[model samples]
Target: VGRIKTAPACSHVPELPEVETCRRALAPRLAGRTLTDAVTPWPRAAATPLVVTGRCIVRLDRRGKFLLLRLDRGWLVIHLRMTGRLVVVRELPPRTTAAFQLDGDEWFCLVDVRKFGRAWQVARASEVVGHLGPEPLSRHFTAARFSAMLAPRRARLKPLLLNQRFLAGLGNIYVDESLHAARIHPLRTANTLSTGEVRRLHRYIRTILRAAITEGGTTIQNFAGPDGKPGRFRSRLQVFRRSGEACGGCGTIIERSVVAQRGTHFCPHCQRL
Candidate 1:
């Protein structure tokens, strides 16, 4: 069997933009395609495995980082937590955790090295992603609504934004970029932001997400589209993984710190705590 192409193992998690990229790429290829068979080399990856044979794929959708395959009968929800990749190829790739055979001689494979990815077959998509917060790019996420959401939260900015229940689709990369653009410190209290700061933060968050999606998401470790292309947004990053690099806004050197138990990057001069 031809080995599946894999990226070197890294800690980067596929966030909203990366997941959206996969959804867009797979939607057209998978729409109306029937699942001929199901195989699970790592059975634990199928959180709610059910009979997927003969189920026609209606469409591909995404919520936060979960890719939703809308089948004729039920939904196939996939979450690529870390080092998990979804690729459609004619040949089976190595390290395939789960694979769905398609009628058109194509195989939809979930190639994972760390085995943290999960798949769920459920009657409703809500069974898997019901608890996720609002999509950052959706129209319902207005500036005023964002301000209201942050008014009562006492959690730190970095951890609060990382929480999927607070706001969906943002991971370390976009969060740092957005916070840097908004001039907010990652450790700042969420409720301490002024109205103007809140507005700036909300706007920057949306802007950065849209930009990343347009660029096919930032690929730090293993993120790639179904077409096997790495994200182009990594080159556009300002602070993430650029610890000693000079800040674009200010010449001050960028710094890295551990916040919310994740590596946080920021400009010491621009974002004052």
Candidate 2:
């Protein structure tokens, strides 16, 4: 096997919206198809390639930031950690980490410039995804439930929102965008948020995520859909990468700061401490 080269650390990793967009693009073409063969040029990219061959993909589902492909005998889970992408084509593209030959002469390819992607074949999907918190867009994630989840946590708002167990599917981008939309400071303590603030946060979280998905997810640099088209949501971003730009809500310039060890963007006048 040839050595697989990893891409540099990405500043804009795929959040829930991007992963969900990939799921949506892949489900129609992948569902009900059987994998006649599987190849992984990088062993590290796929955990159980042996189990992936010859299995029928019953469905494709998304949980938080993970993509779950329901196979006849087990589940095929994929996580595009950074710079990882799934594309379908007649011929596999360069930097292909893994490729699955579908029944209809189509190819489902995992290409990662950074080589940080992962794939797993498991007997139970829950084995991999059971620990994640509620899906933010699901009916189960009610405002009352969100308040209950935040009531006892003292962690900073941004990091707490990024926690998969606290609220699955949020990464730095959406957290910053959502926080700006709600006008809540990233450093605010979870337990310190007033009831109204918590409610507003909850509303904006879902709102921003849904809107991003509708726009096909945000593309900061290398992100693209299975069709290999850049996402339109990047054009709609208000603060994630708008550092030093005038705030959309207030005239104050957006500032960048480090929170949770990740570069964060917010408007000081809008998202005050």
Candidate 3:
């Protein structure tokens, strides 16, 4: 057997943009293809395998950080908790937790070094993924709506943004970048923001997510498209992981702090409480 390849340690979780990228890359290749077999070496890695086998993948969709593979009978929902990756390759790579074989000899592999990935098959997609917040990129997520959503929350800004139930799809990198762009402190209370601050935050959140998607999402570690290509958005990041570097907006030294239990980065001069 050829040497097994493995993904590197991931610094960030697979968020909205990354998950959406995976859906887009896999949809074309997987849609209409029937699953001849489904295998999970780590039994806990997949659930309801009987429902997945022999089902044709009709489409692939994404919500927050989850990928939904619509099948003829049910949906297969995948969550790459931290370091999981789904790739379609001629040969499987190392650390494969689960795999699905298509009728055409093609294979879809789930390689997760940390074994944190999970998959579920259910008759109703909503049963497994219905609780997620509104998609940030959707037309339903207007500035007014976002402002209204924050009006009653008393949590800190960074933590609130990280809540999948609050805004779905924003992880650490984009949250930090959006907070910096909006010139809002990560620790600012959610309900304390003025209408203008809320509007700016809303706008930047959508803007940053769109830009990242256009660039195929940021790849901090181990993230790649279904085709095994790394994302390019990291090159366009302004504040994330740039601690101690000159701020792009005001030349202030970027600083790092612990907020919401995650490493937070921002420009001390640009983003203030």
Top of the candidates by lDDT: 1
CA lDDT for candidate 1? 0.87
Residue-level lDDT tens digits of model 1 in 26-65: 7777899999999889999889765898999999999998
True lDDT of residue 228, candidate 1: 66
Candidate 1 vs candidate 2, lDDT winner = 1
C-alpha local distance difference test of each model: 0.87, 0.84, 0.83
**lDDT (tens digit, per residue) of candidate 2 on 1-273:** 433222111123788998888788778778899898888887789876555667899999999999999898989898888788887776777888988888877778888888888888899989888999999999989989999999999899988888998889999899999999999999998998888998999999999999998988888886433336677898899998889889989889999999879999999988878
**136: Cα error in model 2, Å:** 0.4
Ranking by lDDT: 1, 2, 3
Candidate 3 has a TM-score of 0.92
By TM-score, who's the top model here? 1
Q: After superposition, how far is residue 48 of candidate 1 from its true place, in Å?
A: 1.0
List residue ranges in candidate 1 displaced over 4 A: 1-12, 222-227
The residue pairs found clashing in candidate 2 are 6-114, 7-114
Where does the lowest 10-residue lDDT sum fall in candidate 3? 3-12
Over 71-150, each residue of candidate 3 has an lDDT whose tens digit, in order, gives 88888888889888887765666788888888877678887888889888898888877888889999999988998899
